[model samples]
Target: MMQYRFPENFWWGSASSGPQSEGATLRDGKSATIWDKWFDESPNRFFNQVGPQDTSTFYDHFRSDIQLMKQLNHNTFRTSIAWARLIPNGTGEVNPLAVRFYNDMLDELLANGIEPFINLFHFDMPLCMQEKGGWESREVVDAYADFAETCFRLFGGKVKFWFTFNEPIVPVEGGYLYDFHYPNVVDFRRAATVAYHTMLAHAKAVQRYRALQQEGQIGIVLNLTPSYPRSQHPSDLQASKIADLFFNRSFLDPAVKGEYPAELVELLKQYDQLPHCEAGDAELLAQGKVDLLGVNYYQPRRVKARANAVNPASPFMPEWFFDYYEMPGRKMNPHRGWEIYEKGIYDILINLRDNYGNIPSYISENGMGVEGEEKFLVEGQIQDDYRIKFVSDHLQWLHKGISENCACKGYHLWTFIDNWSWSNAYKNRYGFVQLDLATQKRTIKKSGEWFADVSRNNGF
Candidate 1:
């Protein structure tokens, strides 16, 4: 086998979020977020009733976790600053405890020779801001801008890489369209509004970051699922294109090119789903072009033209023009039930290279989640050979992309440790270090050991 070497100084780490890892949900002056509220209202919605408060307790054990990261030879790590924790009221006096915690955490990471890539939001919207109509209201957008600016002003010096949001589309799909998230509203128009406002917020954050003259780079983390047509037919090709427009280009265009795709705009207009945009919005988005992009690839989207007639009375949706096509013989991740498509990573990079000016990017989040992962535990440590293989497969394609001058700079897995996930909670574990939730013990898995060597060598 050929040695899969990466570029010099290639970043190797993992991505986590405040809402998922930090267990002190309401402690240290943190206000309620949508996660806290939803879990309070319906604990049954979460796996085994495990709420946000029952996470890995990073807030309490960050020192040990940082040590674990050092042991793993991580060069960089990505996590978010909880808006609810930073500003309890959404816009008021900054919480001193939150500031102290983040400052100490960032300094500790720096002292450990690890670079901290900080994100401003990660779907843990402050409940107060959500009450103000979430992303639909321009007021919440302004508040988010303020929160982002606060993050840059407070920690911009220590953190050189900043992201405006992580998977910003998840909220639109989970909250507005799919009913998997809080404020579960199944309305396409509302989903469009949320999506549009999120990009606007992202642009505003970038604008503010540049205005402050921060010596740092700011970008947005998007989970880009490359859309693949089921057949060579024109209808199938058109269907895949539409799906790509709705899910990928909707955010990618504005964040990179500083404008929305013309086809997306026309499609939304045709469906009467055009989001309400304020004056000067175009210029604002134009200013939102990022210096970096974080790409999270796990699966590819297979689609084909809709085979059945549409009901005029039904609410409009992206699917009105396309239908999901599950390709036969596709590789699968049995536990997560998601397609295992390693080549999709290369496809995304190639697309960026050929179409989007080859933006400087990194694989910010990619990992396999296994339900009942404890079944693989052996001799007090998880023999996660499956995970090791999963990562190696993806990195093989990532190396191919980089060799072809894709401009992809690094690779970060989905997580470093087993932590609480939204709704699913800890039902599926995606981590290199397994956390004994019962005793707060951390054990490095086989993959973690393997990754340490890969990071040290900058290859496998």
Candidate 2:
């Protein structure tokens, strides 16, 4: 195998979230979130009929969890603060217990020599706020900015990096388009509105962080899947371009360049679906280019021209141009059915290098998730060679990008332990540490041991 060394001070760690890990939801005076609402309304949508209680009990085992981080040779850890945990109502009273809990978690991570990267939101919107239109309403954006400001004021000195949102499009498409979340709707116009407001909330949060005078970096995380057409036919090329515009540039151009692509804007306008914008939105976004970028590359999108003719009088649809193509021979994660293309990471990095100004960036969430992962059992441990291969292959491309002077600094896998995945529940496990749902016990996998060596050596 080839070898490449990472830069000095490069981050190596695992990422997790509070909603997925903190099971004592009601215990900490934390109110319900959109996830809670969804589960309440329909429990059958979740895999294995699991719910939040199946969350990886990190709220109880965080001290041990941080210890596990040290054993894994990690120098950084990415985690989220549950907004409802801090402000059960999304405004006014602050939960002192929630504050103490987070303070202790941060202290433990730092005490173990792991730098803490905190993100403010990760799709767990407070149910109270969601009832008021969620991100679709300008009021929710203001509330979010307030929430960001409060977190900074409380934890700015201790937190070195803060992120405003994580995988912003997931909510728009999953909830609004695919009916996978609370208040599920399949209207494309509403999806467009949700996307616009989410970006606005991001800008407003950035603006607030600037006002608070924190001496740390803040950014948004986009799950960017580089789009590739199935072939060079003209229609295929056009279809691929539209997919990229919607999935990539919708957030990339605004968050990075502070403006939307002209074609995207025109397309939205022609459909009378452009979001309601404030007078200063342009200036706010322009002045709000992030201090850093978090790239979450899981797979590349393979597209082909539509298989059928278009209706000349029908309303605008992103699908009128392109359809997804399931290419043959691409590696597959049989556990959860997502294509595995390691070079996709390199393509994303190179695009950033040439087109996106080579912004300071790093992989925030990339990992292999497996279903019924425990069955691959060894002598009291899971022998996850597939997971190890996943990281190694992705790192090979990452090493390539770094060798060519791409601005990427580090690699953080999708998770630290098997935690609750929104609709999937505990079905797809992506973790170095395995969480026994019955007892909430933490155990290291064979790959976890291998990762410790990877971190200690700084290369492979």
Candidate 3:
């Protein structure tokens, strides 16, 4: 509290997605998404078997939700449009009801004095698209650009900040390696191809948005995991460098600089598994650097060189290059099991300021997800002291970065309300507001009050 306050124009708010918050998927003639498809196949995968249909029911309560947002002192609100809802078949037909729904929602947000920051894709691909190879096909990239162009034409006037996708790498890890998401496959070649096509799709979307001359800013949100070697040993340092090349630079270099890291390319070439690319793909990527960047930094990667001999029979893994170093006494998220290092947030901003161009950016998604959150509720309000502490600590580092002239604009929580996380369901709550799934009631958490004050005063 001793140092400084953020600038006046900082965009303060929270974020959510259509698939996560807005239930009533079956009612609006909306076809199923990958989540819907997954729940149908394996109900046991989700926590308490809770699926998308049992979400926060924002579809019916959006008007009142906007009023609640005003009470929370939000200057901006981020939400995604469901691709399945936009085009039920994802190509041929447009759902008029879906168009009306989004239009009304955007209008209400504007009327409530909250700027709408819309995201086109948020990891919920339409089930129909997934049935056709999804991002693996070049045709799907064209479809995504078509979808994005349609959104810009429809909501460009009200939505000032547009994000092409949220945490693109999550799918590669979740779907390919971990089997936590739908279409789960543990193939490194497919992972490389998926990663390549996602970046291409992002560039394609941005190019279309600019071509349309829309009255908004288009950017992509990347979850940056900065790498730290466990020790000063040569092998450990080399391991960290390779980890950085694959995890961070693989996308960061292409997104910010429009070219993948040379080391990453060499690694792919070694396997003879590089993704298919056209002659003009590199030029297209270079032409569409984002106007703004949304950074989602949760933690840093602690790495050490592979101490043991590599397993000859083991399946392909990112861990082959390095081992996860468990640093003793590192702070951890009590409920979610993620490490909490407030300095990581500052380090991320400084990296962007130094290595990546000092692009206009902000914390897009960063919050602690706690289990059994209802136990902390007090008299109908959630007394989320832990969440408040988390945000306060992160904000202090953010403020320091700002003081050092890092081009940060503001901080947005991971979410606005407790919503359906893809496979985890209600296992972890990362919302500023507690959502009662059964009753559709929204209660402001203790952290929401802290954020409101930060928004009101422009700082703590």
Best-fitting candidate, scored by TM-score: 1
Candidate 3 collision pairs = none
lDDT per residue as tens, model 3, 1-460: 6355888788889888999989987777899999888899999998899998988888898999888888889988889999999998878678899999999999999998898889999898998998888888788888988998888988888788999988888888888777878788888788888888899999999898899887779888888887899899999999999888878887788888888888889987986668888889998888668888888888889999997988867767778889989888999997888999999999989999998888889998888999999999889888988988999899999999999999999888988888889888888999888888777778888888888888888887
Estimate, for each residue in 1-460, the C-alpha lDDT of model 1 and write its tens digit. 3399888899999999999999999999999999999999999999999999999899999988999999999999999999999999999789999999999999999999999999999999999999999999999999999999999989989999999999999999999998899988899999999999999999999999999998889899999999999999999999999999989999999999999999899878987889998899999999999999999988899999899999989877778889999999999998889999999999999999999999999999999999999999889999999899999999999999999999999999999999899999999999999999899999999999999999998998
Q: For model 2, how does the per-residue alpha-carbon lDDT over 1-460 read when each residue is reduced to its tens digit?
A: 4276889888999888888888886776989998887887889998887887668778888999899999999998888999988999988888999999999999998899999999888889999999999988888888888888889998998998999888899999887877787678877788888998888889888888888787989998889999999999998898889899999999999999999999999988987878777788888888668888899988889999999888967755677678899998888888889999999999999998999899999999999989999899888898999999999989999999988989998899988988899888888889998888887778899889999999998887
Q: In candidate 2, how many Å is residue 321 off?
A: 2.3
RMSD of 2: 1.5
Model 1 pairs in collision: none
Best-matching candidate per lDDT: 1
Candidates 1 and 2, the one with greater lDDT: 1
Worst 10 residues of 3 by lDDT: 1-10
Which is the better candidate, 1 or 3, if ranked by lDDT?
1
Q: How many backbone clashes does candidate 1 have?
A: 0
